[model samples]
Each structure stands twice: as structure tokens, then as C-alpha cells.
Target: MAKIVLITGGSSGIGKAIGEYLQTRGYKVYGTSRNPKNYKSSFALLPLDVTSSESIQNCVTQLLDIEKTIDVLINNAGVGITGPIEETPISEIKNAFSTNLYGPIEMTNAVLPAMRKQGYGHIINVTSIAGYMGLPYRGVYSATKAALEITTEAYRMELKQFNVKMTNVAPGDFATNIAAGRYHAPIAQDSPYKEAYGNTLKTMDAHVDAGKDPTKMAEVIFKILQNPNPKVRYKVGAFIQKFSIVLKAILPSKMYEAMLMKHYEL
Candidate 1:
């Protein structure tokens, strides 16, 4: 029987690339997306809104009815909100946590029983390098991913005895619609740091425009899935991410902060 994998946020970016690549590798891929109209993947597309419990439950139920078992679950749906923590509204912060953190938690809970019964399953959460190193103007996004990293570690330990593996993939600067969505945050009219915030947004856009291809990250994920014992965390992207990790290890906290400020022109 072909292995079954379900990927959330599968309509575009890294998620879509992973779905397509896995399909070619002889896995039966089922992808979830809010809008399924223009998706051209060979695998199935299930309607899913990660923020909606009803939608997630329905999507999972539909898949269970068809496939009976899911070999892997990829939690890849997430959004980005950019602005200083003070400038970011409470509503935006709530929405960020809802989609980025709660969505994955809810989806994981829904899939656990079935996975546990099977005695074999893999759960891959696509986090970001931001989870490890905080960046300016991305407080909420970073917090959500950081929460995910911790949750992934906890799950790795708890689920291992049950024959379920949990892995977190942290990719740096991937080419995706995440950058476009960053500009959609409502600007705070009373924000004292308006000019700085605008500059930060501009810098982010430029970096994303020159980021690595999503397909490269997808390839790393594919290899991880093939391995019987995947690492607890995999960092995917350019050498800069490794360098950043090393810098964080060697540099003092204040010096590291100063270096980031200088590099980002903050």
C-alpha cells in the first residue's frame, strides 16, 4: 500500500512543493487549503481552515473515511505578522497565535488517537529559524514558532514510546507568500515607532525577495520522511543560519543583539 501523508497549507509555497514531491515519490498525498480552486497537484486537496476547529475536524474526518489511515501528518499552515511588539494590536497578536500555534496544536490532537492506534506515524511541524533567534518586528510570529519548538520537543519525548515520531523543521528565509502577508498587518496610527516599523518592513521584503527556493526546503523534508529515525529538529536553508546558530553560541547576549541591530539597520 502507498504511504499516506496529509499536509496543511498545501496550496502554495513549501507545503505545495512537499505535496507534489511526495506524490511523485509514490506517496498518496492529501493537502489542506482554504481555497482549492487553482491548485494543480496530482494529490487530493481537502478543504481546511486551520483556525476553524470545525473545518479541521471535517477535513480529518473526510480523509479518514477515504484512506482509513494516515502515515504522516505535516503541520505547515502558518501566517506572518510584522510590526514592533508595542505597535502590534492585541487582535493581530491573537490571530497570529490562533493560526500559528493553536491551529497546529488542535490538528495534532485530532490526529493523535488515530496515529496511536496505528502504532506507527510521523508528525512534522514546519517551524522557522525565527523560533530559535528572535528578529525585530516579528515578535508575535517568533513567539508562536518558539512555542511550537517547545511543543515539538515535548511531543518527541512523550510520543516516542507510542511509536509516533515528532520532528520540527526550521527553515530560514524561504521564498513564499509569507512576505506578502506581512504587509497586511494593520498599521498603528498612534505608534511612536512608525518610521522604524516601515523601514523594518522594507528590509524584510528585500530579504524575502532574495530568499532560498521553497523546493530546497521541501527536499530536506522529503529526506527526513524517508529516514526511519529522523532528528528531533532539522535546520534547512543557507549557511547563514548555521553561522547565526554558532554566533549565538559564542557571542554575549548584548553583543549578539547589537550585531543583529547593525545587520538589520535598526
Candidate 2:
């Protein structure tokens, strides 16, 4: 029997790539989407709304009823939010955290009982490179992913004895449709951050436009699944993006801030 893998947000982007690749590699892959009927996928695409606890329970129950057990859970469903901190709506910030942080947490909780009963499981939280730092105009997005990353660190220890493993895979910009769904606070003419925020948004989009192929992320996931003892965190992206995390560890605070300011031309 092949491993049963459940991936959230698998209808497209990194999640889609991982699901398709894993299926080709002989795993039983199931991806989730809010509107499963709207997207065509090679593997099973089930209906899921990560924000709702009821939706999460239904999706997991539906999958478990068929598969008997879930061998892997990929928390990849996330939304993007970008804007100056002050201008970004509080409601939107909460929504981002709800989707990116609370949703993943709830999903993990939903599967833990089955996983513990089976005595084996792997949970991979798809975070972001942006989570490693507080980027201008993307602070909310950063915070949500960062919280997930830290949460996984704690989960790993608690799940160790149960044979349930959890890790965070933080990817940098990748060519995907994420930009289309991201919330952007309008650039008001009189706002203090309009000019800088507008320029930063363009830069962010251009980076995504020129980002590496999503297949790269898929390959990384495949390698991770093969590992009997995976690391706590893995990062996939350009050298600079990965290195940014390293630099933050070694570089002086002001110096690193200067580098980011220069890169964003803010």
C-alpha cells in the first residue's frame, strides 16, 4: 500500500506541483481546494475551506473514510496580504492569520487522532522565506507564516514520541497565481507610504513573475518524504533568498535592515 498524502491548496501553485509529482512517484495523493470542481488535477482534488473548522473536519473525515489513514499532511493553503502596516485593514490581517496560521493548526489537530492511532504520520507546514524577516508592506503575511514556522518547532517535540513528525518548508517567491489573490491596500494619493508601497508592490510582483519553476519545490518535497528523519526546517528558492536567513543570523540588525532597504529601494 502506498502512502496516503493530503495536501491543502493542491489545485494550483506549489501544492499542485507537489501533489502531481508525489502521485507519479506512487503515493496516493489528495489535494484540497475551496472549489474542487473548478480545477482539473491529475490526482484527487477534494473540497476544503481551511478557515472553517467544520470544513476541515469534513475534508479530513471524507478522506479518512476512504483511505483508512493519512500518512502525510501538507499544510500549503495560504493567502497573501501586502500593504503598509497602518493602512492594512485589521480585518484583513486577522483573515491572513486565520488562513495561514490558525487554519494549519486546526488541520493538524484534526489529523492528530488518526495519526496517533496509526502510530505514524508526517506533517509539513509550507511557510515562506518572507517569514524569516519582517518585510515592508508585507508584515502581516510575514507574521502569519512566521507564527506557523515557530508553531511547528514546538509540535515536532510533542509529536516525537507518537511517531508523528512535523516540519516547516519555507519557500521563496515562485512562479504562481498567488499575486492574483493577495490583498493589497489601495495606494491612496495622500498616504505617507503610497510611493514606497507602490514601488515595493511592483518589485514583489516582478520577483514572482521571474521566480523559479514550481517543480523545484516539488522535487524538494519528494526528497523530504523519502527521508526517515527529516530536519526541522527546509528552505527552497534562489541562493540569495535562502542566504537572507543566514545573513540575518550573523549580520548586525541595522546593517541587515540597510540591505533590505536598498534592495527594495524604500
Candidate 3:
């Protein structure tokens, strides 16, 4: 029997790419959207809003009732937020955490029981390269992804004995509609950060515009599924983006900060 795979935020972007690729490879793929009816996908799209616990549980239950076993779950649903941390609204920051961090955590919780019962399962949290380091004007988004990445590390050890696998795949920017949905704290004319924040925001958008294809991320996920003992984390993106993580590790804290500041022209 084919493996049953569920991806949150499967309506579009990286999630959609993964679902399409896995379906071609013979896995049973079902993706979730806030409004499943709004998007048309080759595989199934169920209604899900990761921020809502009720919606998350209902989506999992519905899938379990039909599939009986969920072999893999890709927590690919997330929102992007960019602005100077000091100026970003508290409500927006909370919303970002709710979707990017808590949502995946809750989704994992909802699926674990069935996975434990079956003695098998893999949960892949879709984090970001930004999570590995704080970027100018994207601090909130980075923090949310960073939180998820750390949470996955803890989950891995806890799920080990249960025969459940948990890992994070952090991607650099990919060409997607994420920018369209992302929340931007308007640049205030009188704000001290107006000039620097405006420039950084434009740079960030340009990077996404020039980002690699989403299919690359799908390929990485497919490769991860094939591994019997997958690593705790996987990164997918351009060479420079992936290398940034290494640079951050080897460079002195101050030196790295300088490099980032220079890169962002801040």
C-alpha cells in the first residue's frame, strides 16, 4: 500500500509542490487549506487552519477516519512577517507565532496518538533558513521559525522510542506567493527605522522574487522520506543560503553580525 502523506498549507507554494511531487511518486498525498474549495489540486485538499485547534483536530480526525494511518506529515503551513521588531505590532507577532510555531506543535500533538498506535510515522516541520539567523527587518519571522526548529529537536528524542520520526526542513527563499500573503508593518514616515527598514524590506522581497523553484524543496523532502534514519534537520536552498548557516557557526558573533549588517546594507 502507498504511504499516506498529509501536508498543511498544501493549497499552494512549497506545500503544493511537495504534494504534487509525492503524488507522482505514488504516495497518497492530501494537503490542507483554510478553504479547500478555493484551490484545485491534483491530490486532495482538506480544510485546515493551523492556528485553530478545533480545525487542526478535525482535519487530522477526518484524515485518520479515511486513511487509518498517516505515514508522513509535512507541517508546511506558515505565514511570513517582516518589519523592525520594535515597530511590529504585538498582535501580528502573536499571530505569526500562532501559525508558524504553535500550529505545527498542535498538529503534531493531534497526530501522535494514531502514529504511536501504528508504530510508525514521520513528521517534517517546514521551517526556514531565516530561522537559522536573524535577518534585518525579518526578526519576528526568524524567531518563529527558530522556535519551531528547536521544538523539533526535543520532539525527536521523545518520539524515538515510539518509532515516530520528527525532523525539520528549513528552506531558504523559494519563488512563491508567500510575499503576497505576508504582513508588512507599514513604513511610518516619522519612525526612526523608516529608511533602513524600507530598504531591507525591498531587498527581502527581491530575494524571494529571485528565489529557486519550490520543486527543489519537494525533492529534498522526498529524499528525506527515503532515509531509514533521517538526520534531525535538513536544509534546502541555494548554495549561498545554505552556506550562511555554516558561516554563522564558524564566524565570531560580532563578525557575523557585521557581515549580515553589511549584506543588508543597514
User: What lDDT does the true structure give each of the candidates?
Assistant: 0.87, 0.96, 0.95
lDDT of 3 at 140: 94
Residue-level lDDT of model 3, residues 34-125, one tens digit each, is 99898989999999999999999999999999999999999999999988899899999999999999999999999999999999999999
Tens-place lDDT digits, model 1, residues 1-266 = 89999999998888988998888888899998898876776778899999999999999899999999988999999998888787677998998899988999999988998999989899999998888888888878889999999999998999988899999999888778788666345556776777777787888788788889898877888899989999999888779865897899899999999998887788
Instruction: Report model 3's TM-score to 2 decimal places.
Output: 0.99
Tens digit per residue, CA lDDT, model 2, 1-266: 89999999999999999999999999999999999999999999989999999999999999999989999999999999999999999999999999999999999999999999999999999999999999999999999999999999999999999999998999999999999999999899999998999999999999999999999999998999999999999999999999999999999999999999999998
RMSD of each: 1.4, 0.6, 0.7
For model 3 the local lDDT of residue 219 reads 93
On lDDT, the candidate that comes out on top is 2
Model 3 error, position 121 (Å): 0.4
Regions more than 4 Å wrong, model 2: none
Who is ahead in lDDT, 1 or 2? 2
Runs of candidate 3 with Cα error greater than 4 angstroms are none
What's the lDDT for candidate 1? 0.87
